[model samples]
Target: MSKIDSSLFMSPVKQIVIGNIRKDTTIEDLKDCFSQLIKKHDVSFRIAVDKKGKQKGFAAVSIPITLVNDFLNYNGRNMKGHRITVVLSEDFKISKSTRWQQEETGVFKTPSPNQYNSLRSMPFLYKLFDAGVYLTHPKFSKNALNVIERAQSCGVKKMVVLGANVHQCEQALGLCRLFSGSLFCTAGLGPKHAPFWTDEAETQLTQIASSGHCVAIGECGLDLSTDELSSSQSQQLYAFEKQIQLSIKLKKPLVVIEKQAHIETLSLLQKYKDQLVDVVVSFVPENKAQIVKYVQEGFYIYIHGNVFLPQNSCIKKWLTDSDEETNVPFDRLLLGSAAPYHSVFRCTDIDWYPRQFTDDTQHKSFDIMLKHCKDNYSEPCSLPSMLVMMCCMVGDRFTPRSLAEKLTQNAVTFFHLDKSVGEEASVKVTGEKFCNKTPASHHRRWSFFVVTALVVVAAVVLLGVVCVKYSVLDKVGALYNLL
Candidate 1:
């Protein structure tokens, strides 16, 4: 309790909470105690008191926002023979999303940097959800759980691991099982794989699509950009229509992909407009007019990490020009990284997709991944990085806080991800779940591995005992010398 006045409050300042003040402590005593550390005398302290005006063991200390970290060092230190706790109050989140909003390089206004140096340092800023991520793709296949953990560490509470085919869908499901509540997924055959959309693949995909864990249908759409991997245009259209029908039957949204096949893609979408529940386009087309058409058709626009690239001028214009009636609406916009596909990734494609992971090498996975990163790009594309870039692109139209809320809500509503985690209970996926793998088989395999490990350990111990009993160490040493 400072002696000057009872109501000393600071605005635009971080409040540091100091606790465990003794009842006898007064304004002068506290000032003298803290004056050495903060000698400027501009900082203020307010101790909460009981009805009887007795010390209430905690006080709100307002210091220069920059000095918060320095003042935090007093935590757990002896103060009047008592260990006091010092911590930052929940004051930094006023403009949580706005703090991380960055403008394009050489452009700045509305959103300035926060007290923290990096976007990752802003704890509350990480809550923005990443709508799409290829978490089970080759780029992240080594440590399947590693990428998910990293994403969650930075405050990405939710993510959708999209699959381009049935196996990949199962793979996403397998990985998602480890991070149940936070991860959702989609099951669909991409247009490139349209040729393989056999009845069995369709049946498998349909089964996978039924899971409550599966939020939407498709990575399926028209892709005219492929040469070797892409199916014929007609086949792509056929697969797209079928998937749209599937989405209609399942009543789930469609997570679509498109590359240079805009006219055909839109036509098929129009053909099924009445039956389709929802549609999410992964990439923005170059034609601004086509964008208007897609928006008019109620397709949710996905803003990927690549929007900042010079080639995506149309998307940039569409996003920044909020006043345009034909522009993609904020409510219909979603954010994705399509990561490992993003430019930040150093991926060499064999087909349209990144090189698949093959477990042929028996070495340290980290070393291989590290070498891959060094050879290609420095860091794998992360959700948080995409969030930063997208916010920067949209910062011109909206504040970071407002934009973050809009995008977050868009993803939530688009995917229906707000459904209860236990909702998967309602629709049980019957056909071989997670590809052909089952939970019982997984546990049985693990049990076998454990038994084998125990046997190996026992054998090693027996061999060591026999060697020691027979003096094999001396014999081996002598034999080595003789050799």
Candidate 2:
């Protein structure tokens, strides 16, 4: 598929063709399996069975170019029992393209534990969670249900359901109702390449917000990339303002989607600063100053696993430096795997870049902040202390025990969630383990041993050097005296 130049104002339809199914797999079964992958992303494609009525164990899925980029950056690596392959199907010539194309989908391969551990050891990337993503059309009820089931099976307690269409919203609500405490939905209007939300859409959103099921007020924001359904600066502003105001009025948090309209979005946000709660900046900025400005303003930096980006990019440098001084706290940092949708943004046959950052870098980042916190905060400083500092400095000043708690608080306080439902939805996420081991204790046990070894080596070298210098000096002094 042709690269959808995000720099240009063109909306390209990026497709993911899943092939090599186990021939006997029925369309319903295939759909059931693939539905979970697409529900959390913005995709446009249909499912079809081959002539043999057997599951080819492959699928051809097309997603919005933006989503494709996200998928490739985050969750493009492994799926199910298969290391799912991603291919460009747009240029392929197929005799019968019955929604399903016969393109060569790569074989399924799972990484061994050693491979997983080795990959983890590479740099700063750590396995935060095994995320189960769902990408669904707002109208697909059955698909939504399947996704919820799949997420549960995968131990994914947190979920993000894309699209703001009424049916999708309803399906989301249904999932929340069924799962009760397990599921939470992020209401979004999608990109400019796709349909924008209408006033009726707002009403439905408002209704959903009132239901206590909807936690955040977006996947709604601006996308200047797609020319297919272009949005003017004014239109984007108007939409953003409406959602912001809705969030404020409903007392719910807002999730923004921005692409190339950073300045405009920030300007508008500053204009209505009081109304906006938490902001998740999806794409990392190229400019260092802009990142600092956002961090200073208090926005959680959502880092995606994109191969093109380095672990110690300028942003990470800024984060490291910023942590030392209390310029911005560490609790505000959050990691998200922008999965399923990222499958299409592959260059060669490879899809989904491995998670970014090395294990050492990841540990160092955390360690530096912990040390800083220990030195600065009082004795009562707990993990929550670190989390609170991080959240307030880097992200919004609200840190709940779990994602669910945060979502519930966001829902009740920002969205005017139904009183009863909101109360029931409330939960407490487990706190991070606090290290009570003192520095002195660590020093005595480990630092002393290290220092002693170093001192012994240094003493030996110093003695050898002194002996040689004294021997030469003594001979020279005797000759001078004799003269």
Go through the candidates in order and give the clash count of each: 0, 56
Candidate 2 Cα lDDT to native: 0.46
> Poorest 10 consecutive residues of model 1 by lDDT?
2-11
lDDT of 2 by residue, 1-483 (tens): 334333311122344554444444444554465565567754433334445443345555555544554444423444445554455443332323233432244222222111111121122221122111233442222243333333232223344444444555555565554344444566545555234557887887788777665676665666775563353655666777787888778666666667766787678778877556676565556566766766677765544333123442555455445454445343454433343332212212111112222334433433332343222121111122222222332334333235323332332333233344533634333222111124344567798899999999999999879879789668878999999
Tens digits of per-residue lDDT, candidate 1, 1-483, equal 212111111112445667777866665666777787678647655555543445556665555534655677777878788888776654222222221111123221222122221122123332556788777666564444445444444445567878897778877765454345567789999977898888999999998888778889979998888685354877878788889999999999998899888888888888888888789887657767877888899988887656655666787777666665765588898877566565423322112121222222211222333343332232222444444445555656664446666777777778775465423422221111101123354687899999999999999999999999999999999999999
User: CA lDDT, every prediction?
Assistant: 0.62, 0.46
**Model 2 misplaced stretches (Cα beyond 4 Å):** 1-134, 137-155, 193-195, 226-231, 307-328, 343-423, 431-483
Candidate 1's displacement at residue 4, Å, is 66
